[model samples]
Target: MRTYQTLTVETAGRVAIVTFRRADQLNAMNRLMQGEITESFESLSGDASIGAIVVTGEGRGFMAGADIKEYAAQTGPEFDIFQAAGMRMYAAIENNRKPVIAAVNGFALGGGMELVLCCDLVIANQFAKLGLPEIKLGLIPGGGGTQRSVAKLGRSRANFLLMTGAIVPASEFVAAGLVNEIVEVDRLMPRALELAEMIAAEPAAAIEGLKALTAHAVSGDLDDGLTMERDILGELYRSEIGQQRVKEFAGRSTTKAKKGGP
Candidate 1:
């Protein structure tokens, strides 16, 4: 297990579970929290023992937003620096090689919403609410929310939400394809961990390459994206992780049993 200043990481089987602490403040992102997140994510990315990652909040909510008190106290240059750091943290998550699943347990607004958007998959609790509500504070979702919502949903819906700055229920996000699944609050972590374990069971290299390929293909130039995919896949096939997955699958009786299970 690895400990972070603002988060906790625990490993089970090949999955790394990362939980955002600061439940009292709903895990709001302050400067310290942002720094911890960035470092933790970077470390997790390079940790060979971790095959998959899960991100979740520690208590009643996933995250409310940026720490309003901290934001309010920032001056012009200070605010710019703060926002930049937060944006970089989100970008790190988006570019991570290992698949990361977000387990949204409750309110996920503003920065919280942005955090989930960076994940490869998002599983929100039924009681959870997600939104960009930054407009309400005369601000905007600065951490890829504008681009992600538009790309994931559509221009019209994204525009509506940003303009209105409304909070949408978890089911609404699911309907709009923002969230992968919605489970009861009690089941949120289990569902997320299940997903991580499933990914961990797959060929690690393939999982990493698949995530990078899909993200790059959708977010970058197609020709360059395909080339990157091909290169990564070639390297993956030659790695031990790929060989182990192939051997494990080959011995499985597909007709009688599945590749992996509960």
Candidate 2:
């Protein structure tokens, strides 16, 4: 419900959409924007009414990366502080209990692409351009772009993007597995909201558990991952909604058997 200068939050059913509003700057992440992003996601993660979140930007770009003009003005210690804040912002999205979907409407470059790397799913506009262009600026992604890119995309693809700073079409990464789907600019938001609503309709506990399990599967030891999976499964199985859904499914199965259906 709080107002933000850099972004706006609006809810549709159980899905919350956060839109970056600095259109003139391509919605670049200034220090204010970064802090607001961290605050927004962290707050939404705890909101019981919200089940999923979709992030996008207004006008021509999803995000053009950090506000370089602002970055240029920072002192050495200030820049270090900014880097630390960036980590928190990324973590707030990556570790959010509710699923976060990136609705990349336009250019997602440098730190912008890093933000996408934190989401649970990505639905990009067909014409959207994405890349890590930090190398061109004699810098590298201070966010999780270096690591998450390698994990989501293969090492070869991540290496190319990181090293060359190529801003390619969103479709280029679809086959690489970083993008879930690509749609016409007109369909981008509709498709994203459709997916978010579907996810929002699912059992919240199961969805949250699945999110944690998937994150662990990516980074934890195999044995530990398996144990975590089993624990989460057992927890879900014992939950009230889980038990009710199972009973309902079993009842329908019994009725079908009585009628000799397939």
Candidate 3:
């Protein structure tokens, strides 16, 4: 387990739960938090002991956005560094071998929505609000919010929310395909943990390979994607876990046949 000024990480078995600790700011991300989170995920990606990661907010919201006050104070190199850090952090979250799930506990706007977009899965509080409201401030979502919104919600709906800076309730976004599930506030973490546990229960190599293969299929040609899938399938089929499962399946089939014959 590790602790940052803005986040806390605790591993329960194979699932690591990372909680944004700055609830007073609605877990608003600061440059420091961005750097720390990037570091955390980078570390987790290489760690064999941790199979999955869950991100959630404390108090009332997942993350309101970037720390606006801090963002407003940046200039020149500082601003460039901040924005670059955000890009790296978001990419690390999205590309990590271990699955990352966003458990949005409250408000998810602007950078928050961008962060959620990077996640492989999202489970949020039923009453949570999510959007890219950066437009109202005369700035687009510089943290990849604009691109992610379009990718996840499609162009028309993304334009409606991003252009209007509308912050709708979680249910609306769920209907639009951004969120996976919505639960009561009390159920948010439990459900997220449950989902993470399910992912962690799978063989680690297969889980990581599946994520890699799916990501490739998104942008690769069908022939290339099928080639990659076949390669991964061949690799996994020879792995210890895969072989063990195949042996168990054969034993069960033999036992069933013997019982039926006798």
Candidate 4:
């Protein structure tokens, strides 16, 4: 809802779409963009009207990566500050109360791929490419790329991507479970919004609960995750909308039963 120099935020119904506006630079994350990203997602996380969020980029890249020119100019202290801020940016998305989806339009290397790694769902354009190509710059992914990639993709695959710095096609990661779907360039935003809208139609509390539970299942202790899952379910079952939905489903089941429908 606020103006940004590096990105644009707009909403359609209950879904907010954040589009990176640095088309000429392939939407590379500069310091300004990094701060804006953190601000925007943090703002959206508190907005009750927005049920889901979609992130994408303009022109030919979802994000080419961090601006190498900017990175090269950073002093050690400046780089340290930048990295800390970057973590906050990633956390704003990954830990948001609402779901975040990456609509990867093109190249998503280094920090770009790390951005995707933070999202709950990812939909990429057919021609899109993604990798942690920071190794090519004599560096490694400072964002959660290495860890999240290994968690989402598995060790061997993450190693190939991280160690080699190879920018691979979006389809290549589908089997590894990193990508949820791929679509033509024209269909990219539409498909992303469709998924977002589908998610938005659900009870927000239930959706948030599921997001927390799934994140726990991925990285938390099993006993803790099970306890959390049960707690969340119990809470949801007692919620007004949750109770209404359950009753509606039961009513539908009764109608079907009386009509001898399976």
Off by over 4 Å in 1: 236-262
Model 3 earns a TM-score of 0.95
lDDT (Cα, tens digit) per residue for candidate 2, span 163-257:
99999999998898889999988999999999999999999999999999899988889999899889989998999998999999999999999
Q: How do the residues 1-262 of candidate 1 rate in per-residue lDDT, one tens digit apiece? A: 5567788878888888888898999999899999888888888898888888999898988989899999899999999999889878998788887889999988888999888888899998888998899889888888889998888879998998899998989888777777999898789888988988888887777887788788877679989997998899789777887777767776665634564542
Residue pairs of candidate 1 with colliding backbone atoms? none
Task: Report RMSD (Å) for each prediction in the order shown.
Answer: 3.9, 0.7, 1.9, 0.7
lDDT of 3 by residue, 1-262 (tens): 5668889889999999888999889989998889888999999999999989999888998889899899889888998899888889999998999999999888998989889888888898878988888889998988777777777888899899888999889888777777899898889889999999999999998999989887776556889888988999998899888999999999999999989953
1 versus 3: better TM-score goes to: 3
**Clashes within 3 Å, all models in order:** 0, 0, 0, 0
Residue 42 alpha-carbon offset, candidate 2, angstroms: 0.5
TM-score for each predicted model, relative to the true structure: 0.89, 0.99, 0.95, 0.99
Best by lDDT: 2
Residue 36 lDDT in model 2? 98
Error of 4 at 104 (Å): 0.6
